[model samples]
Target: MTRKFTGLLLLLCFACSLRLAAQAPVQTLLWKKQLQARLDSLQRANGFPGATFAAVLPGGEVITIATGIADSVTMSPMRPGHRMLSGSNGKTLFVASALLLAEQGLFNLDDSIELYIGRESWFTRIPNAHSLTMRMLLNHTSGIEEYLEQGDFMQQLKGHPGHTWKPTELLAYIYDRPPLFEAGKGFSYADANYILFSYIVEKISGQQMYDLIRRDVIKRYGLKATEPSTKQTYKGLAVGYARKGGPFPVAGAMVHKNKLILNPQFEWAGGGFVSNTADLAAWAKAYYEFKAISPALRVQMREGVAANTGKNHLYGLGMQIRPGGEAGMSYGHSGWFPGYLTDAAYFPDLDVALAIQFNTDNFRLLKRAPEAYLLDMARILATQVNNH
Candidate 1:
């Protein structure tokens, strides 16, 4: 066999071995101390102001650890309860809620979005408006341009941080824009697809998108600290710090004086939740373990397509599927906001779910990518679980 193919075979074998060894019960206290040490090392090494790490083991045992400062100016020590704006990670919750509605007979995945919001005056203005389906939106195959990538949208967002934007207003940037590609021809990640999805879900269910998420997803899963980023301030929410040379104009305190500088209500179905790593870890465990969705829908959610060429990852519905190497496959999502970066995943072979959140988005300062740190953290926990 070619070297590359041979390498793949060996990697799969190694992962299988790890999974086999992972049946031992986790020693929660030992795992917590080890995780904390790693978290502290990574934080100081990378200059991250603060971070939280959480994991849910095979039998529902949870371990959460925190390190560094939540608000540097106030010298607030980061706590396990501090919630960070989870960025696109919220997409997982949004997509699950949409699927829940479908399970309730409210809609079908193959149904054209036009069937619900097609009559609206602005509906046709969206690229590929007539041909888009709920499945395409869920899987991000709708060929829609990501509104967040548009210069005008970012300008407006940064210019008016407090503006409570409506969905149409956020979508106006891409009103007559061309699709990234023809629908179903290829994969292109786009937040605008989820925006249209929010409209469809709201229209069909006669409830606001956030309400649907809270009712059907969060409440059902008992994710206590997870909620819509609708309000400016939330108790125990961490202050976010932007990278020095980051895209965001504001450098520090994305959440200032206990209030978010940008009104996150506009995020809508496109990742609008702020949550602590503990709740996020719990949500990831429940969702990926098939407790949150039907096994049939769960299968559909795993039907992944190439998200990045040359990357060992795929995008499935709202989740990102990444091979966990010697650990197994991981199903989860990552989030990126101005001053925060978060990653969460469930490793099926090990039956472990992990969530990590950094209060500062200074990835350039890190020795490795934030996702890499999470996988490393997962491997550490996996080994611990195996040893015990």
Candidate 2:
């Protein structure tokens, strides 16, 4: 409490602050190099065709690293800016857009989906159509079975890889099917719910879901590298790879003439967007920080039931929350298309975001899931930030 002691303490604190500020740049460079080396080793050891990783620090610094070959045949190197299918991460947009519309007093989340699409003749055929609410679809509690799990659907998709399917066409596979559970009852992770939700979004807004998402989510957040996967080809898109024996059977490069071998348009609302790691990381940060939506709605998005998808995992609205011990509570989404796999997470406790994308889906060749790689990468970054 003495004046002399207080003055000495203040001087020491100022000196420490100056030292830390001077060391920040050196620490940033070292961490980036370390992250790049780690990614390179992971890709080589795991047989991934290529990988891109991005991280956003608490201080707003962005780090991105790319490794391995982008195109197997052409031998092109993967760049940090190369884009790939983000898979189900697209659901984040669907959920966020719906929330924005709801925030604008356009519609209620608890409203029956039938209120929007009831007039369509085929809507009545959908399981639990009359009782399904928009909230059920957002949280995957609609009880609709997954059309992707149907054998005939996959066979048909394999038969015509180049076909651009309509939403109704995709719904036919699950039409008149038994409900997994009554609407708003037990939880079931089904893309069909989002597909139906997409219809609701369009009917309620009188605009395409893609356009709304681009305007409100992508452009609004300055995610310049993110775009809808409606098109078959995109500039700076990395060529994806998969095993020969899978349902797709596209052994080598999954892209031909810069176009996806399979038309991914059917993924429309189910989850369909392509983005690079930097953009994905930025999106994750903006979203989790509640910049994309109101904090109240974001809290509702995190209010999820136990998701049986993984140990200690929960699926809320369109966001996935998983425990990340030292990294703090993690919230985000994982994406899996035929040839690409992605994982993006934002750690609220640390105020950091990280995204990882692989241009290959050969899980057999890898030792762990994409999210595992993401958490480990996050751990490394967290150490750097914490030390500083």
Candidate 3:
């Protein structure tokens, strides 16, 4: 190109750069205020014991906000940093550990889990355990019966509120049941699948699921407030409540504002962790942004297995995906335990991530406080981000 033509091109590029630089500050301030207002409005409108929400912008700015009572008895207010039960969301942490092990040549995703934790036949049995693979467990395609759904599971928990369960003990309930489907024939969300994952990782890594999460996910990502929910107590933990007629496992407790605490033993790797909204939001940003995950493993995590619901919603190795969206897709998970319900997601097209936690599960009894509330929040956030 001629010198005169090159000089004009440079001037055009400089002008475009100046325009974008000038608009950046205005966009940042506008988004900060808008996101805060939206969260504040949600807190005011939603009725719950405690609520917290956190979000991260593409530029790495983090914001967390909270509202409502942390302790009804103590009348303590909730804070953004207060930790609460993560429930099944902890599955992702263990999945990451397993993936790390896979990278180190410790195990293969396609390896049969029976090669690791064969049924403790003297203790418990799984009819289809021999055919299940590490990938099946990670993707919830193992056909394992959900121990949590057993008729008497809550009764046993109520009878022994503080009983810490051995993995075998938890499996005992499902031992005699037939497989729900042939291994990988279908998908069902089963806590048993992840519980077995904890065993699978431990058997090979020689480390407990909690320790693996601490080393691979929490400490690695600087999730200061995140922790394995293998215990009932935390310094800044909040009280959890259940809706009226809800099945809460607390002994001699009435539904609706009745306190519920998770027995961490049975929870194991399935839903056995706790964290604040801030930590969860950080997770959305870090995990999806490929901070510590390898590109190959990231591909495995991204590929979806069609869920029983439909192709619109898919379940991947450790994450949930809604493949249909106008400008982007949603990938993350929602968690529900006795007293806590949480949802966190990231929208790649919009370059935003968010997490919302409510310290109560109001399913069945009321449509007003359904678990889908967080999903609605996600739609709202995504729309706003994508519009401009």
Best by TM-score: 2
Best by lDDT: 2
Q: What is model 2's C-alpha RMSD?
A: 3.1
Q: Positional deviation of 112 in candidate 2, in angstroms?
A: 1.4
> Number of backbone collisions per candidate, in order?
0, 0, 2
lDDT of 2 by residue, 1-388 (tens): 9999999999999999999788876777888999999998888888888999999888787888999989988899999999999999888887787788899888988888777788998988899888988888888888898888774887777788778888878888888888888888888888888887887778788988888888889888888889989878899999988666776546667799988888888788878899999998988877676555678877888888877888989888888999987898898999988889999989998888999999988888767899999988888877876765
User: Per-candidate TM vs. native?
Assistant: 0.90, 0.92, 0.84
Residue clash pairs of candidate 1: none
Candidate 3: global Cα-lDDT?
0.73
Would you give me the overall lDDT of model 1?
0.83
lDDT of 2: 0.85
* CA lDDT scores, all candidates in order: 0.83, 0.85, 0.73
lDDT of 3 by residue, 324-362 (tens): 355368677778777778877777876777788877776
Residue-pair clash count for candidate 1:
0
Q: Is candidate 1 or candidate 3 better by TM-score?
A: 1
Shift in Å, residue 274, candidate 1: 1.0
lDDT of 3 at 219: 91
